[model samples]
Target: MTRVQANLLLLLAAAIWGGGFVAQSTAMKELSPFWFIGLRFAVATAAVLPFVLLERRKAAVKTSRRHLGLYLAIGLALFGGAATQQVGLQTTSVTNSSFITGLYVVFVPVIAVLFLRRPPHWIIWPGAVMAIAGIYLLSGGHLSALTVGDGLTVICAGFWAIQITLAGTTVKETGRPLALSATQFAITSLLALIVAAIFEPVSLDAIMGAAPEILYVGVFSSGVAFVLQIIGQRYTTPSQAAIFLSSEALFGSSLAALILGETIPPVGYIGCALMFSAMLVVEVVPELSRRRAQAV
Candidate 1:
């Protein structure tokens, strides 16, 4: 695919992801967070089962035991991130959750620097500062009274960054993004189920009550959005994909306003602008540098 096509796919993936946040928030109303996660991932795993089987049959993509171990480890990271975010969402507003979760944009570079000894461009630090400010404003400009959910979500962002980095490293080695995704979903489903069994009262009525929301999340968010993400990222650089995916915050906030009657304060608009500016800086500066080099 051309760069333009790749960028477009990334944008489309972001939109799908943005809408998934809305589904998650809606699902929270009738379902316990763990229960919802368990069901969502269960359905997602089921949705991808056909593809997994077909790939195994057609490509003979059998994972060795050693590779399976790595896949499970990646799945654990994914599960940890999702579980923490869901717990945080229980106590936080959807708008806050969206904004806070986006901190991964900043965390990714930092974690890469720390864990992988990857040196980020000089622009990344300044962009991260702007992103932090944007997050501050997005969280209603109240820096003084941050809650447990805020802290949890921030930690969740770090885990998400790690997951993305691990995915980049491992997906290439495995050449099995689809199969890896399936494994991750299955692992997440099982983990969530165990958590729910321990802490949540699972009842037939509860399941029935959450049926619609569960189906939406499972089918659209976990299953479809994830597949799109894998496909879209295949054609784009991680940096480009990150900027395009940041559109999720904008889309999520707008959807919340339209569907849930959630209102963004004036400060939230400022936050949105700052975050967009930061993304532009991160994405555009490098492109301009490359163009300059080409001109020389």
Candidate 2:
């Protein structure tokens, strides 16, 4: 649970999340966005419920109305981000979806500064600029290709940042992170179901057709990746966690190319490099300084 170990786990979580975009995009072909989200979160809730109950049994976890309210609020934010991102994916490429979603790293610090009144380090701005450029390249270089989906994904990133920040704030107060996660998923599933009932054509056929992809996203991305994020962030700072998680875009783009026959233009690769370099500057350089100071 050292910082290095935590960071590595975050990287693995990002890789899983990266591959998840492919599953989500593919499933969208056979399912409506709300249906896919509902099913995915439903499965995620089921997967996490057992672990949550087990943890509750081992520990004296007390749940109050206030705590439930907090979890519900967090869940709503998560649901909004997921739903919008899925809708965006319907019209956007996986690469575009991921790169734009990855903007949460930038958004988190900005939100921290603006809403939470937390001042960010000087490095955050430069890192954000680098990530923006990287996203542009990752989106195939021409800003003209940006669509409403891209805008929605950007908004999704902001919501996700808020969710992450809120989750970090509440995790310490809640004894059962797993249970909280389960509750969040359950709430999200319920909300998605409501949305599906009204807007989406949620039939059994669509669910069955998208079953495999939904299972992958639910089990690996939502269930497992989220748990890892909670655990890993316990040992890392939010900014550091953001840097590690941002790797999802890089991993997603590469996975899409290999698995989905998607290819990024050369300029896109350069953009990815620039974005990654900026993250390294933000995260790695501080650690290097600490190590050097320790050596002296």
Best by TM-score: 1
lDDT value for model 2: 0.83
Give Cα-based local distance difference scores for all models: 0.79, 0.83
> How does residue 244 of candidate 2 score in lDDT?
85
Query: Residue 227 of candidate 2: its Cα lDDT?
Result: 83
lDDT of 1 by residue, 153-267 (tens): 8788888888877877776676777788789899999999999999988778878888887887788777777777767777877668767878887777777788878876788
Candidate 1 residues lying further than 4 Å off, grouped into runs, are: 1-9, 57-62, 233-241, 287-296
* 262 Cα displacement, candidate 2 (Å): 1.2
Residue-wise lDDT of candidate 2 within 144-238, one digit each (tens)? 86787887898898889888788767766777788878888888889998988998766788788999999999999988898898789889976
